[model samples]
Target: MTRPTRVDDLPIRDELRGQHAYGAPQLDVPVRLNTNENPHPLPEALVARIAERVTEAARGLNRYPDRDAVELRTRLAEYLSRGGVPIAPAQVWAANGSNEVIQQLLQAFGGPGRLALGFDPSYSMHALISRGTGTAWLSGPRRADFTVDVEAARAALAEHRPHVVFLCSPNNPTGTAIEPETVLAVYEAAQAARPSLVVVDEAYVEFSHGRSLLELLDGRPNLVITRTMSKAFGAAGLRLGYLAADPAVVEALLLVRLPYHLSSVTQATALAALEHTDTLLGYVEQLKAERDRVAAALAALGLEVVPSDANFIQFGRFADADAAWRTLLDQGVLVRDNGLPGWLRVSIGTEAENDAFLAAVKSVDVVTKKEQQ
Candidate 1:
């Protein structure tokens, strides 16, 4: 018998045999606007709080972390309730990251022989996680402008009747927010087709021009709203994400989550971050302003910039986006080529970082050279 030298030779899962693990390239560049990370480092006061909290938690490290993360959940609920929508602790759940929160949702409500649906060019993770959990994935339609066409979406929902539906408000790569009317419409269509679980991935909502859909969870048991601290909290390295849904929905996820899934250190750090939510949110306002500035500058340069509510701008109608991406990378600025036909996304950074990106764009003369080329 021949030795198994490649993945193809091994008895791998049929679906995963040729699949690539999903992620943007984490390049070591000077200006990394590629990954949509909060450019601000965690404030010093919060760092001190984290140290104090972790020291206390370390004393009890011999025991398993709060298997349920009850206190952490309670604080999270309080943090979310700042919107005037009361979120009870029981309605909140936590995991290592929003990616894990999504995975657990898929495990509980989606799996072998089931289907999950999302609009294309949205978060890629929705499809990848679905496949990883043995759930069939379906692509819904987005209009030329990247907004979901309500009628087409409803038709798809009725036809496919997916076990899970993902709606990414302030959608990744595009930075467009889904209107409440569209979400309501989609939820109704899903319910009519089947008792489906509709997940609204609000991972970037903290920097949005509009409010969160968390308030809508009151009457919609099938609805779920997932959030992350990575973006707004300036704690991306902390790896904490959570969701708000009906208690019953959270109860379903409980069955699929591993024991002690959240470490004591994570809980401590997240709790510390929550204590400084006010200060952290001040940074969000700054990013939101910078996002507007970047979008304006890109449009002024004659790039086709999609209107953004999130903390990034997707721009371009480049004849070869990869060329544009490579050009920027050469200038020590990195942005994402999200595989969209002629578009790329750049996360908003600090004032100086954003300035560097703009300078690079102007220096490259991307728009002017296109006509000459």
Candidate 2:
């Protein structure tokens, strides 16, 4: 038999040689709260509307999708403006997902020899995408509580003077939202170092306890806010993400965007989702309530829980997080072990699903106590 070739057998980018793709475990379980996805299914009305729009788009399949995605951009702008920021279409850009949007930003602003910096334990993709784009990555500092150490961040900016900076509001895994003052301070510090592009990953902003940072875009040409339909819209499968930024930034991104990158079907589906925004947001309210309920339940279990502004909660001070995760899995519940040492994360599922997860946690506690005895 011929020997099987391994991935390392062929020459590949040295940076990607040993890298693992970013993902949570996708397992078949009764209560799966691993991925921070909106637990609610889209309403029937929205589904019907998506069908209608997609059907219309099918008629134009022979032709290319609007290369600039003008209509979709306009609708996205309108949706964002509802937050009172008055965003214009020219200042918005959409891509397959926030990942693609992040890649485009890196392609335009970060490349070989340039550095991109993000506080530790942020959206990992910031560093991953930087490496993918041939950009150097720098890890900045965060407080022990998972909040950005603003002064330390300023100092990092001064020292490295990276070309790009990434800030994640309502940061993942930890579920901590950055304060507006921190953002402003970082932006100022980044600019002081050089005219750096400061990108804010606001993918969870819709679920945040605080307001969206869109309003801060005024006169800040280097500032960009990236958002996604995957979370609040209950449309993770939609794969639509957009960014609000200065017009010039949008133009720069155009320089690197592939022609007609977004397919017609995606634009139509996203358009339909926008039409039913109110109904979808109603589900967001439900998730927010459920999130709070689950957080309280977890804290009541005597576990350490990080105050979250996203749909997921980060809880634990487990001596062995991996063991705790496996125990939950054994109990037919799945959650994320984000490699945060003593912590594990769980997305807020439906009321019943959350109840099951609580029960599983209680069981784990019982087992641990018995083993000690």
Candidate 3:
């Protein structure tokens, strides 16, 4: 029999030769919270609306989708303007997911001979996407609490003079939101160093306790804030993500975007979701409350809980995070061990699911109890 060729056998780029793909485990567990997904299903009303929209779109599937996704961009612009930022359709761009948004941004602003920087332990995809685009990746510094250290970040920006700087608000894994002051500092430093593109990944902003950083876009042409429907809209399956930036940035992205990148069905479904924005955001409020409840409950158990502005909570001082993750999994509850030593992240699920997860955590002895201060 002929041998099956291994991935290593293919002549792939040297940068990708040994790297693992970015993903959390997809195990079929009773209470799955590993992927930071919004646990709620779309409302029946919205489901019906999506069906109507998709059906309307189906009639024209023989033709290519809107190359610029005009109407979708207009609706997204209006939706963002509710944050008081007054965004225009010309300033918005949509893609498959925030991953694609990041990929496109890197393709345009970063590549061979250019470097991209993100704080250590923020989103892994920023670095991964940079590598895929052949852009050198640099890891900046963060405080022990997982907040970006302004001075350290500025120093790194000055030292590396990276062409692209990524800032993730309500960052993943740790669930820490970058302060507005820190974002401003980094943006200024990035520009001072090399007039770099500062992309803020706001994929979880809807669940934050603070206001959206959308207002910061004013006068900062180098700034970009990326968002996703996967979390707050409960539409991960829809694969819709977008960014709000200067009109010039949008124009630049046009140069790198695939022709008719968004499918008609995607645009139709996203428009349907936008029509029910208020309803979807109501779920965000519930998850915010549940997130706080989960954080407090974890603290009450003497486990260290990182303050989270996003829909997920990062808890534990587990001596062995992998073992703790497995223990939780053994109990029919799954959480993310984000390779951050002593920590694991759990998405805010429905109240009942959260209760089940807390119960499973209570059963485990792997959690290192936080010492009373």
For model 2, what is the error of residue 225's alpha carbon versus the real structure, in angstroms, after optimal superposition? Answer: 0.2
lDDT of each: 0.93, 0.92, 0.92
Per-residue error (Å), model 1, residue 128: 0.4
Assess the local accuracy of residue 76 in candidate 2 as a C-alpha lDDT between 0 and 100: 96
Task: Report model 3's TM-score to 2 decimal places.
Answer: 0.97
Runs off by more than 4 Å, candidate 3: 1-3, 366-373
Which window of 10 residues has the lowest lDDT sum in candidate 2? Answer: 364-373
- The TM-score that candidate 1 achieves is 0.97
**Over 4 Å off in model 2, which ranges?**
367-373
lDDT value, residue 219 of candidate 2: 87
The TM-scores of all predictions, comma-separated, are 0.97, 0.98, 0.97
Supply every candidate's count of residue pairs whose N, Cα or C atoms clash at under 3 angstroms: 0, 0, 0
Instruction: Count residue pairs with overlapping backbones in model 2.
Output: 0
> Model 1, range 1-373, lDDT digits (tens) per residue?
9775988778987887888888888999899999999999998999999999999999999999999999999999999999999999999999999999999999999999999999988999999999999999999999999999999999999998999999999999899999999999999999999999999999999989899999789989999999999999988899999999999999999999999999999999999999999999999999999999988898888778999888899988777788888889999999999899878899999999999999988855555466548
lDDT of 3: 0.92
Winner by lDDT between candidate 3 and candidate 1: 1
